[model samples]
Target: MENQEVLQQILKELQSVNQRLDKLEAGQGELKDNQANIENKLDSVVEQTVDLKEFKTETNNKLDTVVEKIGAIEAVTKENLYDIAKLKLIK
Candidate 1:
């Protein structure tokens, strides 16, 4: 009778261990799914960062061109002002 009780207790402990293992397996599956989702989000952020860098470079190039054109206009305006002043002095 004592041996039967021991066997029953062992069986109960084994079942409890099995339940714990099942819970751990379920948790591992959820962790894997969450990891996959996080990786996908990271990939999207990397792509957007690349796009933003390219846009910034293009904008900087456009700004540089505009500055160069403004410099040219200023030089021409100065030259025209000098000519107008000399013409007025001669008159």
Candidate 2:
């Protein structure tokens, strides 16, 4: 009878140990999932930074073209005004 009681106690202790190990395994799985999510977010941020740089370069080129056109218009207007003044003087 004593041997049977001892065996029962040992069985209970083994079951408790098994339950704790199961909880630890679940926690490890959650940690791995969190790590994967963080890496994905980092990749997205890097892609956005590259896109912004390209847009800035394109905008600068367009601005330069507009400035050149304005300069040309100013030169033409000055010549036309000078011609009109000469015509008035002759009259």
Candidate 3:
């Protein structure tokens, strides 16, 4: 009878250990899911950063072109004004 009681106690302990192991497995699954989500978000952010860099480079090129055109216009205007002044003086 004593041996029977000891066997019952051992069985109950084993059942408890099994339940704890099941809970740990469930927790590990959740952690893996969270890690996957974080990696996906990081990838999205990296893509956006690359896009922004490309846009900035394009904008800068456009601005430089506009500046060059403005400089050319100023040079032409100065030459026309100088020619007009010489004509008035000759008249």
Candidate 4:
């Protein structure tokens, strides 16, 4: 009867340990899933950052083009004014 009691106590202890292990396993699984989710979000952010950099470069290039066009127009206007002055003197 004493041996049976000891056996029953051992079984109870084993059951308790099994329950703890099950809870720990469940927690570890959840942690892994959360880590994956975080990594996916990070990847999306990185992609967006790259796109923003590309857009900034394109905008700067367009601004440079506009500045160049304005310079050319100014030069042409100056030449036209000089020609008009010369024509008026001839008249």
Tens digit of lDDT per residue, candidate 1, span 11-76? 999999999999999999999999999999999999999999999999999999999999999999
Clashes of each: 0, 0, 0, 0
Highest TM-score scorer = 1
Ten-residue stretch with the least lDDT total in model 2: 71-80
lDDT at 21, model 2: 91
Better of 2 and 4 by TM-score: 4
- Candidate 2 residue-wise lDDT, 1-91, digit = tens: 9999999999999999999999999999999999999999999999999999999999999999999999999999999899999999999
The residue pairs found clashing in candidate 2 are none
What lDDT score belongs to each candidate, Candidate 1 first?
A: 1.00, 0.93, 1.00, 1.00
Q: List the residue pairs that clash in candidate 1.
A: none
Write one digit per residue (lDDT tens) for candidate 4, span 1-91. 9999999999999999999999999999999999999999999999999999999999999999999999999999999999999999999
Candidate 1: segments with Cα more than 4 A from true spot: none
Candidate 3 residue-wise lDDT, 40-88, digit = tens: 9999999999999999999999999999999999999999999999999
lDDT (Cα, 0-100) at 70 in candidate 2: 91
TM-score of each: 0.96, 0.66, 0.77, 0.74
Tell me the spans in candidate 2 whose CA falls farther than 4 Å from its real position: 1-18
1 against 2, candidate with superior lDDT: 1
